[model samples]
Target: MIWHSTGRSEDGVMCHPVDGESWQKFDVDYPNFSSEPRNIRLGLAGDGFNPFGNMCNPHSTWSVVLTTYNLPPWLCMKESSFMLALLIPGPKAPGKDIDVFLRPLVEELKFLWQSGIRIKDTATNTFFMMKAMLLWTINDFPARSSLSGWSGQGYRACPTCNEDTPSYRAVNKVVYIGHRRFLDADDPLRMSFKFNGQPETRPTPRHFTNEDIQEQLGRLILRKPGKHPNTLKENMDRQGFELNRSKRSIFFELEYWSSLQLKHNIDLMHVEKNVGESLLGTSMMNDKSKDTSKAREDLKNLNIRRNQWLQKRVYQIEKENSPEFHKELSALSMGSQMDVYTYTACIINGVRFMVLSRDAQRKTQNSGVLTVCENGEKYYGQLEEIMEVQYPYDYSTVIFRCKWFDTGDIPDDNFISIDTEKEAYQDDQLIYASQAKQVFYIREPVNHRRNQNNNPRCVVEHVNHQNIWDLPSDNARVQNAYSDSVQDVDNVEVENVDIVQKDSSPGARLFIEFSHTFKAMLT
Candidate 1:
């Protein structure tokens, strides 16, 4: 029980699974409301997924899911915990009619927010009044408008910065170019991109931010949607119920989550999918793939310029003179001429360690060692996995894929993410140490079967010892437990794991014997 201390009594905890410093921002930002552990923060997510494997069925399935950030790292992710708010079956996409489908869930949420329900915390074995509040809605670009009560297309598309989105007349239809307003006048991003070689004419009212249009407020009022400035007053004339009656979503009334600038964010994977598909459609010369997208005369000019740039980088200039070439050169570690890969230390079994990529050669194995949790070690458990993009890495990443070390700690903040994979702790995942301390990976597993149809992931087999005291302390100790050469499911060389000491002591040892256990605990 001493070694398994949950740190509930400690004042010095940071990234807590339930109520650590992770939720401090939301609480600190709002001084009017006192921070309490029982108040739940959550996010509503909805996506139209096809239940049928084949498109021949031709039906869309839209399901609303709510995730709670009130659970701990261990049990926060169990599928049984995920609250299925609603299920909307559709022969066609819900479009604007989606509000009718979301009413019941919203009403239930309204009741829960106003009058909390009695709930028991199994982890601490206590009963409490559990009041929940919606944080924001999560969805892909297509589903953003449907769930968040906002238009996702055209100039009025941006949920946070309404109508400030710059636009240019493309053909006959008005096409919104990009978020020209999101950039500063002198920002490098302002020059990074341009529409048809012309810099976007900056948005009017030059010094404006998302706070101008979107705000978290107490009242959710019905209004005619779109770019009109006087939308609230316009709703007075239009009096009806259901979809026709109100264009504004019931979500605006939550009162707690009203402050977020962008409530509805399109999933990045969908953006990547669109880009990849478009690039694929553009790459091939054959006519068979011609239907992938409409042919555009403008694309020809774009391709011509891209080709010219590629040629200049490849042939026209010396490699020493190119900035991009120099960047690649800088990627190589000093003396280790081969490219450098990075390793971010992840806390595993309360010990700070990192799994190097399988492709890491002995020479470049220790190339770019980034030791987090070395001094300021972040807590790891079923929760706290992050996937980020880094240079020079195709599959290189840090997986927070480790176990809950029942170190003496308890989160004082009632913050946990319920949107987690059940087997998150079991598999190897890449992660970044972010302040969020969110329980689940933002995306799916690295090698999920659905993601890579050709190469199905082999089921991972883990050897669970009865107690942490019995777990391996050294490579030899680990090899003793496994019959078939201490290998992961992927059959990589995991035997070379290096468990460096996290203690800041000038000369500390790895896994010191229990001889000093009593003294250490007393200290």
Candidate 2:
């Protein structure tokens, strides 16, 4: 058959060959392939699923999917371009027996490698040969080890790197991987660890050659013994066809196939699934179920994040503060229960409580515009949204804190620089999880202090029944209150009486007191 002659031997062009295999031609194709034959650039993918969509079924089947990178992007993923390579019908997991199912594909691949299929070159009006090359394999995490002939667990768990996972045995011979640390003799901060009283040292990573790995299999038989043709075992062995698929996976003795690197990619979907499974299993297996510390260290390699409630951003009361304040803050629930207590002085249930408000600013009657000094650190930071936190020491007692951002994107129109009384407070989604016990007050220089504490802005007032105009004019009360500073005082009076009825008493009392000096001038 006439093949795609990349470099014409008749034209005196040097066509390099190694082990009886042509090299330069791989990059060139027949004229039928537009200009030259497209490089196979093939990706082999396999996944097992039930065709019946019966979850209750115990049987399983795997399908080998083949797609070529040579195709245009739009057509690459089309069903028409996806060629089926093999189907491994199964009632149970194939395990190493997978080689049995792969025999057909292997035989076909060998034939294609040595004697390619013949087809007429439409442009040249002549028959030429063409071959497809296996470039890479793509499989989920479970299949990674089987396909790559590499082990992904134990001390040498990592398939791609020589990072030896440091493992130790506990009371019952249970192996647990520990945190990896770089040995630094010069750095005093690096806590030194010892195993069996011997200082632990970083291991020098190991490297293995493909041939070295293949030899470790001892012997391999790629085909079924029962189906072995009358051909002698000695003959197949001599020709190296008797090797297991894992060893044969090196594609030994094949002209161009021997050198082609068959890369097996890790499918993220499966990796994520496995990681989640491992965490769930570990959690449920424990008596505490949510054993935060031990489980976190045991599977630290996964770098799994703690649940949202345990994350760092959740504000917590500082233990440095008095234990009573911290204890009180810790006991608060999501909503008002009893009353949450803060040290800042405020009125709740007609009783006073203490709380802290640094650089408190009064809200404008028209707009809630407040300002405070920037003490070295930001007061609120990015959490501009406001939330009211109810103290649990008494009923109707509450303090305001900075609400955390929502899981979804905060609409710019909702959270951005809009000055509105209605939008100042956050919508319901901003509520903190139960464990976020410490109040996270807003500290941003440009913070929107929402309608909290019944105060418009930072202006605070005590509700009293007494009226200012009703105070004694003799200034006796004011003089008695600040006797050391003032010799006299003035009784506050209403210049214009708009006498309003209070509970049909036809009178309301108000009191205002001033120093003698100011009182004498005003009167």
Candidate 3:
């Protein structure tokens, strides 16, 4: 058979093999271009025996060529590369015979390219990729009989099945190519071998079947096993894999297969480690090397101290400002009852004051008096009585009183009426009638005390007189008066007044007083 290089250089010299060697060279003959450059071609004889044994002599054939030239700048810096395809002459068989063999080789090349192997760098040169493709074809299939799995005479039966099946079946059977197929006694292609150069009559060895070969290959390719590093057993301890211990053989099979794959790539270590860490990181399992009991005890103590601190704060507030304390306590109680309390606060001026409750239940008991001091002075009050004045609206109205004014004196007459027409009397003209009588008049001296003793007394006419009754001489009367009048009025006023009590308890009474000066400040 003859081998030829297809593409031409510009020169008239044919771009052919230089000699019957592993390499060849040719020159490019440019007709009009000023630069004349030679291109190189390299070839490799593919592996596998040619059935005819008539293709270019395998050992002595030309495989590659490099031509001499004033190399281009790009080529001068580095050695040029080329892809080599070994051309095998087609058999004298009828119809599409060559194509049938070529297709499978091409498919295998494509598969190799897809598996993370870069065949070429487009930026550098396309030659490397082409070379990879050519390498795959040659390595995968050198000749038609290499694929057809038949001798030159096309009379050899399949080695595995020993049947006179189609050539295609013979190729597939002996080569162990394609997906595996399970066997059954009823199958037309049941295991059988050739005997005495003809189709065999008996079943072939089960081990020679396609299914058995594939199963063996699968086991060989696995990446994990009991004894392997990062093995299935180690992975189970680190991560974990569920398996039925009852099916020991099946379990071993899976692990063996997985281990084979692991050996081929250690990059899967990260994935294994992550999975293992996640499984082993659960909180339920305590580290045997650590003091787990001590840690738990410490957590318990911390919680106890936190609860004590909260109770102390509540007590202090209740003692200091009973009204505010009660309001907060009430709010907490209400929130607890409703089971919706999340946050509670009392803000004074722009500063936020917070009372924290652990949960809804704790909030119900939150109300109590809180005493707070400003400067050196201590003041006590209830939370509700403390007015909440917001910014911009009541900012200017916020005030605290440091001192108070003292007013002294009581009016003598409980009841008094004044007439506008009465003239003012001089001090000297006024006279005292009798010290014993609790009566006084304001009038001209001439008309004073006219009906009674003829002593002059000031008679003020058309003026209402206030009667002064003597105090009750006994405690019984006082008690009676208090029970009937004093108690009713005081109780009514206390109830109606918008006063905030300091104590949070329902029955506890605590009062907080803001002085009149403080009230004025609010306005």
TM-score of each: 0.44, 0.40, 0.13
- RMSD, one per candidate, in order: 28.6, 22.4, 38.7
For 1-523, candidate 3 gives per-residue lDDT tens digits of 0122223244755433222221221112212111211221222223233464667643322122122222332342244432333344433321113333344444544443233233544455653322111211111222322322222222223233323222322311322211123434455333221111122233333334435434433433223322455455534342111111111122122212222211111123455665566556533343432224443344233232222233445667877875556553433222111111112332121122222231123434221222223443322111222232222211111111111111122133443222213323222121111101111223233444475434433332222224322233453312121121111223343312221111223432222221112211222
Q: Write the per-residue lDDT of candidate 2 for residues 355-374, one digit (tens) a residue.
A: 22322332312111122234
- Give the CA lDDT, 0 to 100, for residue 461 in model 3: 22
Candidate order, TM-score descending: 1, 2, 3
- Comparison by lDDT, 1 against 3, better one: 1
Give Cα-based local distance difference scores for all models.
0.45, 0.40, 0.27
Model 3 residue runs over 4 Å out of place are 1-82, 85-142, 146-154, 157-162, 166-523
For candidate 3, the lDDT comes to 0.27
lDDT of 3 at 489: 25
Candidates 2 and 3, the one with greater TM-score: 2
Each prediction's total of clashing residue pairs, residues at least 3 apart in sequence or on different chains, is 18, 30, 58
Over the stretch 397-475, how does candidate 1's per-residue lDDT look in tens digits?
2223333422233243433222222333243333333221322212324545456423322222122323232235554
